[model samples]
Target chain A: MMTARAAFAAVAFAALALPASAITVVVADGAPEIALRVGATGGTISQVSFAVAAATAGTGTLILGTTNAAAGSAQAPNFGTACAGNNVRIWARARSTAFSPRTATLTVNGSGNLTSGANTIPLTNFGWVTSGGTEIASGNFTGSPTQALLSFGTTREVSVCKRFQFLNTTIYPSGTYTGQVTYSLQMP
Target chain B: MNPTRLLASLALGAAILATAGPVHAEQPATDTTAPFAVNARLNFRLTYPRFLRFRVGATGATVNLMSFTVPAGNVGSGTPVAPTGGDAGGGTGVNVLVYGNNGQVTITATNSSGGLGIGTATASDGRINYNQISSVSSSGQLPAPVLTNAGGTTALPTLNSTLVTQRTAVWTYSYLNQTIPSAGTYGGTNASRGGRVTYTATMP
Candidate 1:
C-alpha cells in the first residue's frame, strides 16, 4: 500500500512541474493618458507653448486638428487685421526608450482651421521642425485631415511653430475673433 | 517525503506560481497625451453725424417773391426782373443754392388746376404760360424744364443729377398774365392763376 501511494504522489508532482518549468514574463499594458495643458490663448503679438509626454513603448502617430477651414498659414480668429507678427509652435523631446527605437509620425488634419462664426484662420500658417531642429515644410493646410505633418524615425523631440504675417492692415474690420483645436496620439 | 511535508511543499509552490507574472500576455504598454481645447480672441469700432440745406440766392439766404400789382392795361404784357436777395415780386428771377450729397431738387405746380393755363389753349385750367427765360449757363449746371402753355398737369424742371457737393443754379422768370377772363389776384395762393411753384429736395 505504501509503495502504491508513493507512485501516485510522484505522478501528481510531475503535473505541477510541467507548469513551473515555463518562465513568467511580467508586463504592463498601456496606462491612462495624461492631459496636455496649454496655459493660455494665442494672440497677434505673442506666441504660446504646448507640451506632451513621451510614449512608454512601441511606435505611434500624433495628430493635430482644427475646427475652422480658412485657407491661409495663420490659424483662425484670424488676425483679421493682418497685423505684422502672428504664429504657432510645436515641439517634441527625445525618447527615453532606447532599445525599441520606433519611428513616430506627426500628422495634422487638413481640416484644421481656426474659426469664429463663419470666418476662419487657415492651418497652413503653421510649420514643423524635426529633432535636428530645422523647418521641414511650410505652407497652407491641405484638403484632407489625414495629411502627414512630420515624421520621427528616431526617438527625439520634434516641434512645429507658426508665424502669421500680413503686410497690409487696411482691409480688416474691427470685431472679436475666436476658435478651437483637437489632438490625437494613435498607433496601428 | 512525509505525507504532510509533501502536501505543504506543493501548496507553497502553487502560491509562488500564482504570485508570478500575469498568466495571459498583455499588449505592449503605450502612453499618450490627452486631447486638449485650444482657443483665441479679437476687438473693433467707427462714427459720422447727419446734415442738409438749400437756399435761393448768392447770399445763401431763403427768399419769398414779393407781391406786385400790374396795371389793367398791361394784362397781356409780361415782366422780368432780377431777384436781388429780396421780396420784389412781378417776374423777379431767383438763384438757387443747394448743398448736400446724392440729393435732387424737383419743382412742381401743386395747384388743383396744375398750373397757369395758355391763353389760347382749348382747356384753360392746367397749363402755365411761361418760359425758362434765362439760366446761368449750360456749363454751370444742366437745366431740365417742362414749362409749357398747353393746358395739362404741369411738373416743372427737376435737377436729376445727384449732387456730390454744394452747388448753385440761377434762372430768370418771365410772367405773362395772359387774357384769362377775370383780372383777379394772379399769384401767391397755390390755387390762383400762376400760383406757387413747389420745390422739393430729396436724398437717399
Candidate 2:
C-alpha cells in the first residue's frame, strides 16, 4: 500500500501530466481581448490633407504644400504629439492565457487608388514611415489586396506612429482624392 | 492521512491546474482559446485645391521692358524690328508657360489705355496702335494669343484631352515699323501711355 505522502505526490504528478480539457469556461468579464485602435478617437476615421503650392520657377516641378497637423495619440516617443508632422497614432494589444509560443500578427490592405471625379492617383503613390513601436518595414502600397505590417508575441502591447506621404513627382488634377484601408490583428 | 482527506487533497490539486486568473465581470470578453482574428478599420482622405500659373517675358513680379529703335532710312518700311533688352532671346523672344489643373485655359491681354500715347504729349503728337506689337510662338502647342489695342482672349488647345493643361513655348515679339509719326517716345513709364499689357489667364 502506498503511504499518504506517496499518494499525494502521485495525485500532483497526474494533475500536471493531464492534457488540456476541450471544455472551456467562458466568462462575461472583459480581460483578454485583442484590440487595435487608431487616431485620437479610436472609432473615428483619420483624415489628412496635402495642399500643393506653386512651383518655384516657371516650368519647374510643383512642390507639395504643408501637410495637416499630426492627430496621433500621446504615446511614448511621440508623447502628446506625432513623431513626424504627418503621423497617425496606432495602438495594438493582445492578451491571451494560452501556453507559450503565442503570437499575434497585424496586417493592412487598401480598397484601391485614391480617386477624384474621373482622375485617379495610383495607390502606390502613398507610403509610410514608422516610429515609436516595433519597427515595421517602411514601404509604399503595392496595389495588392493585402500586405503584412508587423507581428508580436501575445500577451503584449505596442504603440506605433505612422507618417504618411504622397509622391508628388507628377502633377494631378485639382480635387479631393480619397481612399480607405483596413487593419486586422490575428492570434493563434 | 484519512481516506476522505486524501481524496479532498487530490480534488484541490486538479482544480488548481485547470483554473485561470480571476476574470473581471464588467465588460464583454473575447475567448481566444482557438485561433481568432480582430479587425479595426482606418479611412484615409486627401484634399487638393485648384491652381493656375502663367509666365511671360520674365518670371516673378518684375515686369520686362522691350524697346525697339528704327533707323531714319527704314521708316515706314514695314520691317520687323527686334527689341534690345527683355528676355534671354535678345529681347525678341521670351519664355512662356501656362500651367493649370482645371480643364481648358483662356489667355487674354488688356491695356489700360486705348493706345501707346506719347509720354505727357498731346494728341497732336499721335499715338501708336498696339497692333504694331506682334508675337509669334515657337511651337504650335501654345499659339501666340492675339495682342490688339482693344484687347482679346484666346483659348489654348489642350495637349491631352483627358488630363490637365500644361503648355510651354518661346514667344518672339516684334515691332511692325509700319508708319511714321510725330517724334516722341510713344510709351514710357507713364501708366496712361499704355506702357503695360496685363496678360490674364482663366480656367473653369
For model 1 chain B, the run of ten residues with the poorest summed lDDT = B40-49
Worst 10 residues of 1 chain A by lDDT: A50-59
User: Which runs of model 1 end up more than 4 angstroms from their true locations?
Assistant: A1-188, B1-46, B49-52, B57-63, B66-68, B71-91, B103-112, B115-139, B142-163, B176-181, B189-194
| C-alpha positional error of residue B30 in candidate 2 after TM-score superposition, expressed in Å | 11
TM-score of each: 0.28, 0.59
Q: Per-residue alpha-carbon lDDT of model 1 for B1-204, expressed as tens digits?
A: 999999999999999997552211111112443221112211100111122345443343343553445566665464432333232222354555444433443433232334444222224333434442222312245242434432223222333233333445554444444433444443443434444444444444
Query: B1-204, model 2: which lDDT tens digit per residue?
Result: 999999999999988875533221211123355565655555556565577778887877767777778888887899978976667576778888887777788788887566453333566777777778888888787877777777644747464445476778888888898988667776655668775677788888
Instruction: Count clashing residue pairs per candidate.
Output: 24, 1
The Cα local distance difference test for each model comes to 0.34, 0.63
Q: Write the per-residue lDDT of candidate 2 for residues A80-162, one digit (tens) a residue.
A: 34445566665566776656445677777754877888888776767776664444665777777667777776666556667
TM-score of chain B of each: 0.43, 0.71
- The per-residue C-alpha lDDT of model 1 at residue A120 equals 39
What are the chain A TM-scores of the candidates, in order? 0.39, 0.67
lDDT tens per residue, model 1, A1-188:
99999999988865543321111111222332211111113223122222111120001232222211211122122122111122233332223234544444444454554443443334443332222124336444463665665554334433333332211111111122332232322322
Error of 2 at B29 (Å): 14
